[model samples]
Target: MTQIQNPIIPGMAPDPSIIRVGADYYIATSTFHWTPAVQIFHSTDLANWQLVGYALNHGEVDLRGTNTPAGIWAPHLSYDSRTQKYWLAYSHMQNMAGREFNSDSFAVSADSITGPWSKPIYLTSIGFDPALFHDADGKHYAAILEWETRTGYQAPGHIVIAEVDLKNGGIIGDWHRVTTGFTTRGCAEAPQLYKHNGYYYLLIAAGGTGYAHGVEIGRSQTIFGPYEPNPTGEPIITSSPQHLFSLGDPDAGHFEMFNPQSLMQKAGHGSLVHTQTDEWYVAHLMSRPLAGQKKNPLGRETSLQKMHWTADGWLEMADGSNLAKMHVDGLKDVPVHQATTQFDINDDFNNDTYDPRFMTPYRTQDAAWVNTIENPGHLRIHGHNSFFSQVNPAIMATRATSLDYTVQTKLTFHPDHYSETAGVGLYYDSNNWLYARLCQADTEDHTVLRVLQAKLGERIDHLTDEVTVPNDTAEIRLAYHQGTAQVLYRLTDTATWQALGTTLDVAYLSDEGVNGAPGEIGGFTALFNFIGSVDAHQLTSFADFDYYTVKNNLERGTHL
Candidate 1:
């Protein structure tokens, strides 16, 4: 059987939506507050996956002044056999400050999963976690959670099922409140509906997206019944299975013994798919919390558990337990691709389109900023806005692929005036990042490299704090040994590499580590390495990004 090392899809790939097209499988994940949203991965076997494209093009949506983790939420992808078109349903969680989580579900159609996708059409205001289920006959239904607040409630609101019109906006029929207070942990969400063996099954994510998280299943003879709970009368999949409807509530389960050491905690929020081989697997979001922490890594990534239908017709996990892990021996064998822990940061910029892994902040990146035609060998970015804004800017970055890696890039700057800046750095979030950039000194057109600190809330930049070093062309490298980060720069062809004085404590920059006052510690997403030119005086500057490569396990450290 194919053995997937834990975290088959790692680094901030959360709320995964999976669809198998022929022998190929594609998964799309959420990219909240990170522009160029909805990362898609392709896999011949579930274990080996590579980033392919993004469902949303940059500037497809406007997210100015968006809060951390508030731009885009769960996106559901489904395939229509009748039209042979890939249909996507997703929710943009526009406002979180008011705790609204007011979802505007939208739909987009693409002939191919690697889409030249059509523009999105507003589906409905159906709360969040919008899923599209197309019947064998081409009839489509949208199953979504109607999150509402009530006084003195059993945690939040109910899970409602409605038949939605794909061509039109919402369902033509009335919504049925399937379950009011499921109480499986605390909150119930991420509902996916499937029909198997003369029955309609509804899978839900319950327990507040926390350490108490779990997956609960129910079935009915009709499409939407007063759905009957599982025969066990509890969630079909849950860590600390003995407990139901509550966590740390011993009163919920009386039969099972207590356990104190569980490796996979808060494992739930899932979707089930049958492979081409007719084997069933459930893809759920799980978190790898920081050591000894019950708190999540600012992300809930996708994990899978195998399932089998019993003689009694109840869908149960193969191992009698729900927690997914490193390997499953029963399934068919899957091949492991090259065992590479390093990546190159070089760009040819020859393709008509930039790689999907390269993304800007909120709003569309100007096509003019990156020129394959105008500048054949280099990238010219006419920086219209600064990096501080969530809108238009020439900022592009990739996920921190690993914790231990060396990232270096050669940059040649053609600076015209002061106030413009360009450079690369280790970016966790907008507020919490550190790196060095080449800026044109206000007094002279000569470009001087300056190291900048992006700490949250302290608006006053300590530019004068670091001695400005002169460099018209320099090769900059960020070497991260475990938690310590050192910035080094060398003049072109120079054997001597000058260490930009001072080291940064990077352990605090991770989502599982330290969160800036305004920044939240996110999941195990990558610290991006990027190169850009910020224009100071409408001077069109070109940055010849020679190459960028990331290698993991370059060295281990003691700090973190």
Candidate 2:
């Protein structure tokens, strides 16, 4: 079993939808505010997964001013064997100003999971986490909860199912209301359907998506039920294992009873997948609080737990407990694969094109702004004023996926003009970043290395020491040590570094800080290691970056 750290997928990888196509398993996750959203993953053993592509890549949605936690919500991935088509279903959570739960659900189809998918066609303006269940009778059914405030009856939020026309993408029959779910598992939602042992099993995420989250099971002999709750009358799996139902918190399906001893908190909203070896697994979302409290830095993450079927015909955790962890062997001894996250940082810079792993800031990339032919084998980044106020400027950034990692790169320069600064740094939002660059003063054309820091909506203030770049070939290393970070610049040709200072409180500059804004957190956002050249005042001199690399000497506890 591969000893996966609790979250198989981290950093806001919430509402994961997994599907099995023969021996192949794939996962599609939600991305809120980021462009080219809906990341899809593929795996052969179910334990080792790799990102294959994204469902939305053509700027189909607008995400400006999206509040924290409100861009794209739950997304569902499913495949049809008859038509050999892969489908992506998701909700665009447009407005959250009133917490009104306004969402638009849609679907897109592709011959392969990673491909030229058909354009998204609107399905319904309903609640989130919409799933399409293919019935054995050669038909498809759509399941979702209709958030009702004016039903005027006892049940406001109800789970409804209807026959769906997959070809035209529309509801084809009268909607049927299944049970609102057992009283103990209140606020029942994120319904996923499966068929086994002559029963249509409806699995749902119950309780709120908060402290009292759980997975509940209900089965029916028919696609549309008369569904019966698991005989246990308790959640099949949950973090804070509870049977408590108040029926008072209007959001919790109006139930008041709950269990007390749950280990994994907020363990709900999951999808099921059966491995090639006939083992069953559940991929769900969970969060880790800050030390003792519930201030989460990395938002809802994806976790996997083993599950099995009971003799009584209901599905449950393999060990009969609701905790997220399982004792079964997952992929404990899988060999380490080559680095899939990035490229070799050491570069001669004479290459005609940039590496694919490198990306630009908020704007689309322009190829004409850079040229290596001017000076053979040297990167000539013509500074277009400071890092700001330019769309197609020279800035190269890479994703920071691990908690602790070291980044190193070499810089060689012959700047005869003033105000040219080039170096590496960590960036979160547009308003927050820190860098260590070598600059030349306009008056004497004197070159010096300087460190700078920027806070929320503030200028990049020069923080510390200024010294000469010992030699022309300066090697720089930045170590992001957990919550803190440090920068060390050395001249490889001279073999000595004039040390600046380390910023220990990196959390303050993260999405958990004052600037990391909404509909934007971990999913659609990331901290990047960047290599840039800026002309403090005007574009005069050029800063040449020889190569860049983030090290394997991670400072985290696990030494990743």
Candidate 3:
């Protein structure tokens, strides 16, 4: 027997949709505001996974000026055996003003999972989290959450299903309104339909997306019908299995539902896949808060839970407990790839191309702003807007996968004006970040390094202490541990690293600390360690980065 650790895909990999084609398995996760969206991971033994590629890499969708936690949501990945094609269904959340939750759903297909993806075909504007299901009779059905804005209705709305046409992006006829949720835990969304043993099972995420999050199921004999809820009247899987009656509740962050016994919180939004040996598993999203706090800095991650179908056709955890575990049993016959290596960021800028794992927010990465071929041995990033702008910002970032990690970068930037700055730090979004950059002082011939922070839309500058750089170039490093960060810099590689600023508490950069809509949850994204440039003076200023490296301090056996 092999034991698989939780969080198969960690650090900002949420809303996982898993499918197994023959012996190979693939999982697609939501990217939110980060581009090169729709991350797809490949796995062979269910214990080890690798990020293969993304489905929406060529500007298939526009995410300009997108708000926090409101870009691409819950991307569902499925395959049709008849056409031998892969399908992806996702929602582009355009606006959430006045609780309208205006969004448009779209679908894209490819012959292979990696490349030549087709243009997005518009599916519906009725709701979000759209998923496509191919029936045995060759009929295609679409399921989505019809958002409700009225005062007295079932808060977030019901899961609606209808026949859809893939070639022409339109629904067949009317959409049947199914149950709002299987249990009293309301705020139902992310509907994934499956057929097993002559029954159509509809799995949905409920209890908002917070501490009370859970995976609920219901079944019906027909495609559209009054489905019967699971007889247990509880979620099939959740972090907190204690029963709670929260029907029609619009709040997403049920902080009171946090369970003390489990390190993994906010476990829900699952997608199921059957292994080749007839075993079952569910890939779900979960979060791990700080030691004794309710803030989640790493954001929602992907975890696997072993499942079994009962004689009554109801799905449940293999251990006969609804509470999620930190370790689960692996596949029966397949040997576990137990000792996997973690990916560390070590870009030397000597190659002609940048790392494929690097992603930018609020804009796409193109040769217009980011160029590697222009500078042979250096990554010349032309600064665009300021870090506060929800527009185009020159930032090359990677997910912060470890709780304690160090990020180092060498910058050769000569800023003539104070508005042109270049440096590296941790970033959450446009409104919340901590930056340490090199900028020009009041005089023209002097350069200085300062630390700046943005928390809940308020700017705080550490003007008390500033380090002067002699030649306008230096090596910058940020060390983060638990929930605090320290900025350090040195002019040369041989010199010792000197602290530039006092230790700052950056726990506010977590998902529960950032600002969002007036009545909704705070943020859905995690903290990212980034090397960026800000040239508000003129877009012509560019920063030459020699190398970028991220060193995780966790032991190999624990984190991997």
* Each prediction's RMSD to truth: 4.7, 5.8, 1.5
Give Cα distance to truth, residue 27, candidate 2, Å. 1.2
Query: Candidate 2: RMSD over Cα atoms?
Result: 5.8
Tell me the tens digit of each residue's lDDT in model 2 across 124-200: 77677788887656799888776655535433367778888877877886778896776565677778888888998
Q: Write the per-residue lDDT of candidate 1 for residues 1-560, one digit (tens) a residue.
A: 44555455655677888889998888888887776778888887776678888888745777666665567777888888898999887888887544456668888889998888888877677578888888876678877887764545543456787777777566768877787434446567778889898888988877654455677888888776888887776666655566654532211111122223555555677778788878887777765443444333324566677788888888878887655554554347555542344233446565555555676656556666765556655555566555555555577776654445667777677676676777787665566667577776656746777777665523334456343445567778788654568888887675587777667665555554434222223333334666666664664665666555555552342101
TM-score attained by model 1? 0.85
lDDT of residue 490 for candidate 3: 96
Give the winner by TM-score. Answer: 3
Error of 3 at 113 (Å): 0.6
The better candidate by lDDT, 1 or 3, is 3
Candidate 3 lDDT, 1-560, residue by residue in tens:
89998888878899999999889999999998999999999999987888889989998887889987789999999999999899999999989888898999999999988977899998899989999999888999999999998888888998999999999998999999998999999989999999999999999999987899999999999989789999999999999999999999865788889999888899999999989999999999999887788888889999999999998899999988889888999998788866434657799889878888899998999987787787777888899898888889899999887777899999989897888999998999999999999888767678898998888889898887698999889999999887899999999879999998689999988988888444345887998999889988867899989899998777733253
What's the lDDT of the predicted structure labeled candidate 3? 0.89
**Residue 524 of model 2, lDDT score:** 27
Off by over 4 Å in 3: 339-341, 516-520, 556-560
lDDT of each: 0.66, 0.65, 0.89
Which is the better candidate, 1 or 2, if ranked by TM-score?
Answer: 1
